[model samples]
Target: MLQAKMKNGQLITLIHLSKKEVEEIKSRGEEFYCPECSQPVLVKSGIKVISHFAHFAEKNCSLAENGEGAYHESGKIQLYNWLKKQRYEVQLEAFIPSIVQRPDILLTLYDKKIAIEYQCAQVPIEIIQNRNRGYLNAGIIPIWILGANKFIRISQNRFKLTPFLTQFLHQFSSSYPLLLLYFCPITSQFVKIQNIILTGSGQAFGSLSVKKLYHSAFPSLFSVDNYHEALTYRYWKREKEAFRQNVRGKLYGEELAWHKWLYERGTHYEYLPSSIHLPVKDQYRMKLPPWNWQSRLLMDILHPLSKGHVFSIHKAKYSLKKYYSPSVHFPLIHSHGEPILQYLHLLERLGYLTSISDTHFRKQMIFPFYTNVEEAVKGDRRLLEVLESKI
Candidate 1:
């Protein structure tokens, strides 16, 4: 502990120590615990002026692993080497002022200064907003070079819009040109950078390559407006709306058959009171016939049916076919009922069919002889027809 002389002529231990003493402590193999948290400090030692220590295990610690410090150190070294190769003034990880936050790099070009950030992960929206505000206040242009993981790692080939991401993208869509750089792990350097348009939904539009660097790849940048436009154009080109419209049109044709089938079935049975009800074993077996040659042919023609409806049909058929046959698996026949009901529930959720209420069925089933079999047949036929067309 370092001792200090107080004005009151009292000797006290000074909490604030010099950098040299801190270094000496580290060099002497003495663990430097955080004075604030009392946790072991992990130090990245032996630096050409870039050195810091902090608690690594604490989740709330400012130095928690975000790849920022490592990226900053490696980025500065890389930028310094690049500038030296280009015969330019080399200043790595320089500090700037606007709201008092220092950027990763400050490049001096003739009479102007440029601020650059090497971001390897998705940064918090607040941080990005703050950086933008600071850059604007400082009157220095800010450039962000994002890693490949942001664009290339996403599996969706077509762009999609989420409310939050869309808002974020729209905010920066036309502000500044974005530079996308691909880092090479082998060389521990950025191999290529390209200017890419980012849509209002954060989709990559197109790339413009740069080839000026010593490596085969060079870093590139794009204006925000161009990025947004390009992304919108790409999204429109995918044309999912047209596909949905086509599906809707085909569905309209088969709706008549389904209406007929439902009307003919009426609501005489207890299960028919609610569309959500599971069919009783005997009722389910008697209602639908097994998959005969004709039915099988029709199902084959309607190759692509909704998964829910398909499950219902297959379950009904399996249950009936196995009812009287003792040799057939009982579990397999009973197992299909749950899946069928689940599928019906899904269709109801999607707004394709209405639930059968007690009142509606009671009115139709007033007379014992008054079975609406014709309507049910027509509705079933229509439904099957529509499913066929979809397939």
Candidate 2:
């Protein structure tokens, strides 16, 4: 809707046109057509809304049916102009011939091609994945920036990760935690929620960095920040306490099943070892919450053997598969790596286990058990120290 083709096949954006120019073009009877479907479109210059093109009511264009509203139009234009100001070769709503997709803004950085999509409205998850795959197949890195208005702030440092936003999380490297990007055109601010470690299925604790659009360069988007060790542990401790007190709250859905499985194993939620529910950066990959799979790993894989028990990570991964499911749909997430292995590595580094072979580890010590939140926080503090060292 931002850019349309004129009768002469030249592309023009209504946002860049002056009111007088729009009036002159309308008076002269110049016609514009949808760039996606190549159907005639009408130019609307409204006082309340930004100038843009739209298809007629009877038209069945897919783009028109999607309804790119004023906010999306403005955001798209703002991003295109922002990238253009940096002297990057950029295109607005450029149609990709190979995939027949029109990315909002396409940028050519040296030899790299990037497609920036400023999604303001709710879209089907399948469609989003398809678009991402299309760009990936074309050798274009697709960067999805969410609308800042979509963020539901829960606290100073935490925000609600809606199902829609969860799919867009980017994990560039296994070492780098999941990161989210949000832009508010109204405030002209870009919010980068980086190094996010989810505390629960729906809640996350992370570093939120906000910068003005004009002040930040492109490379800043990919930069990861150190998560405050004390702040992160403080929040995790509270979550652990809540989990401890709220047994009834979790008696539903998959959690109920997990609890039943624990009951069969002669252990309950509160009695699990302190290390079971601690923060694991790569825990996002597992379907069950941290307590379930982490506890299962302790009970089934790590706790059954004597002190001399040596096991391979591959065996642990295979044993944990029933509890494992892809929780997030981030394409950049390393699919081949096991999140449980990462947790096992942390345990190894903490001196509870020792690496005896490339993929096998020897149990050095027994799992430490804690009776209260205070003891749990101490265990979490030790784990947090290992996590912070990676930063």
Candidate 3:
């Protein structure tokens, strides 16, 4: 195992230390139990790594993997030590019998007890709700510290939250203020904290400023409120509408025409479907390009039709006319060519086609033209018959 460097100029390895060495550290009174599971930890000795403690398990612990939970455990230890330095009466991994839940850290200030949950992964809403109930039943304040990239607090009466954020909020009502802490893995630090005000449904409705707590290095106070106007609900509605419009705008017109072309020719021609595997001449192969960031981006921007589904060009055009001016149609047509080229290249490379540059030979196509016709027909037998006659 790798060794960590300690501030005391001692290198500590993860290997088991002797009983005498463990006793020597305990004599110093620096030893502590795991806050979460009450497991004993002892400092190990090594030259290359700094001195650090490891849990002394009577039996092997399952949470020994090098992952987010392990990091959270380590962070909890560091945080507990830091809090102790500040003279706060704190308990690590304190279990509350009333709630049947264990909090990462519990701090008692006079009569008030606070339960802090350090979440490093996506936890279920039911779990959070049960835990929240447990803490509230125990007359303790529950605080959740989420991992960075999990959420962000936008403004008063308007916050942008994720599914995970929604789940966390749904379990606990608007009783306690939610503090959104952004954890930075690169710097190994808690970068910032935003105070989140939640709605009745547990959605984050707004945010407040943070007050730096530890010598401008840690946040001490953050407050968020003023979400009574249902602004977040309105903002979310508008955002969803805007996204729909953007998607439609990117995919309409000439792009619609390319989709129509695929729909009409897909079955007779061996066209590859988008992001699915289909049978080629003798074996199954990918119909569309592999799903990747760049390809997805291109698909979003270009709106190419999938070989698995046919595009109804006339219907799409009519729909576009209902919402857009005729002058804006052609630009969408010109934008889809790049994604088409990309699709064609992918198909050729996957052995669905013979050549990347060759676009004329219909037999080289992988998708059956019938897929597009199914889309164009849209459950109308007459339309199917008409399309079939044309083919």
Best by the lDDT measure: 2
Model 1 regions more than 4 Å off = 1-42, 45-72, 153-202, 208-213, 216-391
lDDT of 2 by residue, 1-391 (tens): 8778988899997777898888788788788889888888888886777788888665777678666588777778888888888898998888999999988899998899989988888879878888888888899988889888788778777788765677788877667767788888888889999867776568887888899999999888888787665566667766776776653753688888897898798766766676677777766667777887888888888998789789988888887787665543567454425678778886776677888888899998887665665566566556656655654
lDDT value for model 3: 0.41
Q: Please give, for residues 1-391, the per-residue lDDT of candidate 3 as tens digits.
A: 1222344534443323555574575478663543334455565444533244556654353222222444555555555666677888887655566665657789897898987666776655555666666677678877666554454445443555553564333112234333455443323455332333322122343443432224432224333334432332343333323222333445454445544654564332122223221111101011121222222322332234432333332333333233222321211111212223343334444433344233321124333222453332232233223323432
Estimate the TM-score of every prediction: 0.39, 0.88, 0.40
Residue 190 in model 2: lDDT: 91
Task: Compose the digit string of candidate 1's lDDT tens values, residues 120-204.
Answer: 5565655666666676667766655543234343333333222222212211232333234444322454423223332222243
Instruction: Choose 2 or 3, whichever is better by lDDT.
Output: 2
Misplaced by over 4 Å in model 2 are 27-30, 58-60, 172-177, 226-234, 246-250, 322-329, 333-337, 368-391
Which ten residues in a row are the worst by lDDT in model 3? 277-286
Off by over 4 Å in 3: 1-70, 97-100, 149-160, 170-179, 182-213, 216-219, 224-241, 248-391
For candidate 2, the 10 contiguous residues with the lowest summed lDDT are 327-336
For candidate 1, the lDDT comes to 0.37
